[model samples]
Target: MAVLVGVGMLVAARPPVDVLGSFGSLLQTFLPWSGVGVLVLLALAALRRSAVTAVAVLVPAVVWCSLFGGMLVDKRGAGAAGGDLTVVSHNVHDGNPDPAGTARSLTASGAQVIALEELSPRTAPAYERALAESHPYHSVQGTVGLWSTYPLRDVRPLAIMPWTRALRATADTPKGPLAVYTAHLASVRVSLAKGFNTARRNEAAVALAAAVRAEPLDRVVVVGDFNGTTDDSALAPVTAGLRSAQEEAGAGFGFSWPASFPVTRIDQILVKGVTAVSAWTLPRTASDHLPVAATLRW
Candidate 1:
């Protein structure tokens, strides 16, 4: 049984079938959590006190470490001392109970660039009022918005969904012009009947990726609630050419959803041609999702 478990993990490393409602993507979403299996195997090996079981346990342990061990070490500080820009992304739940307090909490981070998703007309006013002092330049297209301390230009809405759920803008920072994309991709679901449903989110990801590819700006920053992790194959279209801020310079997984007890990272700060100095998740606000913040050099 121990050997079989290790073998199963090795098989999982390769891409699995996705025809059955994106089963492969679903597994990939929580692939990091598979390490827990190794712990169970170790306990079993200890109880049996068999050399064979001990050797079998080593298989999955090595595989899990090889897959995510690097993330355990601290890779920050390269750009930590002096970063050219700071950005934060959050899915401030539409049904949040305290919009004013949430906005205040976000502003306290002092991120120069902030992108928010799931914003409704009623709650947006509170954000606008609270951010007016620090992030003077702001743009909102439908449910998504961008607030920045620098001047903004060529602000436009993206057609990734039926209604407005994404936007793009050019931030005129001291470094240069940066194409900033704020998006809230269609949410996915999991059910026994349909398995993992990601068709809508996959289509939106393709559209978003196309926009990023055609962007003329040399520096680009994509911040939002992706609804899928970078590991999920369904999001490859959008993550193919981009670098995740957390993977580049963060201490751990940096999960940002379910503010009470986050298990996976859905909100992301992905960049192209911008150096990520540090990436971290902020304390919970009134929103269901915790905010993700990153500092960039250039």
Candidate 2:
């Protein structure tokens, strides 16, 4: 039993051959938790006094550790001195009770570049008013917006979804020009009706990935609520050339969803042609998501 389960764990990373693999991908999003399952097996093995089962348990345990062990060590990300440039990404739940308060929390982070998503017409004004004081140069393409201390140009919306949930622009930083994109990919759902309803998110990722691949700038930063984890195959297109800030510089898993208890890191900050010196998650705000920040250098 141990050897069979161990082999299963090893083969899990392979793209799903069928529906089971699709479902496995969903479970893999929280793959670290699988260690707990192995623990349960170990307990049963001890109670049964089955030495074979105990030996089997080690297989899955070792396999699980190999896949997710690095994240267990929270290496210090950035430092107090900070990086040359700071950026933040957030999905300020449109249903949030206090849009102004959320905006204040974001500005408090001292991010020179900010990307915001899920803005309705009514709440948009409050965020604009609250952020206007600190961020003088800003642009709104569809529901997404970018606010920066430096000048911005070549701003436009990225039609990854039916609505304008993604946008791109050029941030003319003192160091140089940085192409930036803020995106909210289509939400995914799993239910009895559908095992893994990822078609929409997959389609959006394809379009966004094409845009990112076509980007001409050397330094590019893409940040927002991806509605998919870095492990997700659907996001492979967008993630192919870039790297996630959290994986490169975060202290730990850096999950940033369901502010009450973050399990999956759907929110992200990815970069190319630059380094993420530090990446970390902020305290929970009035919204459902915890804000995410990253410091970058080329």
Candidate 3:
């Protein structure tokens, strides 16, 4: 059991999947609580007067907590006085039964810029119409879209697929041109032979990273359901230059998936050359993933 838990921890820390990207996000949803389980086992062993078992349990508990405790800190700091923009991101589950409700909830978030992924053909029009009133400038490509309060310029599609995959839009904000990229990377599904497959996700990540690296804009924001975690090796190429808004400003772990019982934050907002003042996970809605909001100062 100890060895199994240790292995699980390692897998949770670094998802072990191929072709798809769901494993890491799945593991992150459950791994943080494993330490508590270890502690419980240690207590039970101690109660049974099994000294050896107790020691084994205690050691792993301490080690695990020591390794990841800092991540539990309320990283979201108080909002700065001069934040230039506020952004929100969500997957909005393609099969969401309540598009109007989701739109209402998002509208209440008061985000100046909204990035959405998993936008199905049937629901995209509803979202576009719903947000049209406040976000006059908007752009969509494939399943990804960006709605901005400011004027959008040079809107284009990102190369995440053999065809159009993601969307990129530049907002002409008062501070400067803010380049926004929205993507719903390849979804990972379980298979018989492989525990997790992330090939397509890895390919998309590489392509996205290359595009971002070649971007001419000084300020950039990337948002969407990455289907991977900040710690996942597959995401290293993108995380190398950008800072996670939740990691910088959120309090505690910002889990945003499986809305009914969120365990991982595959939905993310990453920024470059901007200060994240505050970040937080919003309340549950009709979608499978919860929304994430962040304030940024230039």
TM-score top scorer: 1
- Please identify which of the two predictions, 1 or 2, would achieve the higher TM-score against the true structure: 1
Alpha-carbon lDDT of model 1: 0.88
For each candidate, what is the lDDT? 0.88, 0.84, 0.82
Q: What is the lDDT of residue 291 in candidate 1?
A: 95
* Candidate 1 lDDT by residue in tens digits, 84-154: 98899999999888987888888888788999999998888889998999899999899999999999999
Tens-digit lDDT string for candidate 3 (210-273): 9899989999999888887786766788778999998888887789988999877788899998
How many clashes show up in model 3? 14
Each candidate: RMSD to true structure?
1.5, 1.9, 3.0
Which one is best on lDDT? 1
lDDT of 2 by residue, 1-298 (tens): 6676667766655556465645765765766566777888999999999998898798888887887777777655454355668899999888878988898888888899999888778778888888888998898877788899888999999989888999899999888999999999988788997877777887898999999999999999999998878877657899889998888888788999889999889999999988888888988888888989998987
The lDDT ranking, best first, is 1, 2, 3
TM-score (all chains, Cα) for each model: 0.96, 0.93, 0.87
Q: Over 4 Å off in model 3, which ranges?
A: 1-30, 49-58, 80-82
Indicate the worst ten consecutive residues by lDDT in candidate 1. Answer: 12-21
| Reference-based lDDT, residue 104, model 3 | 82
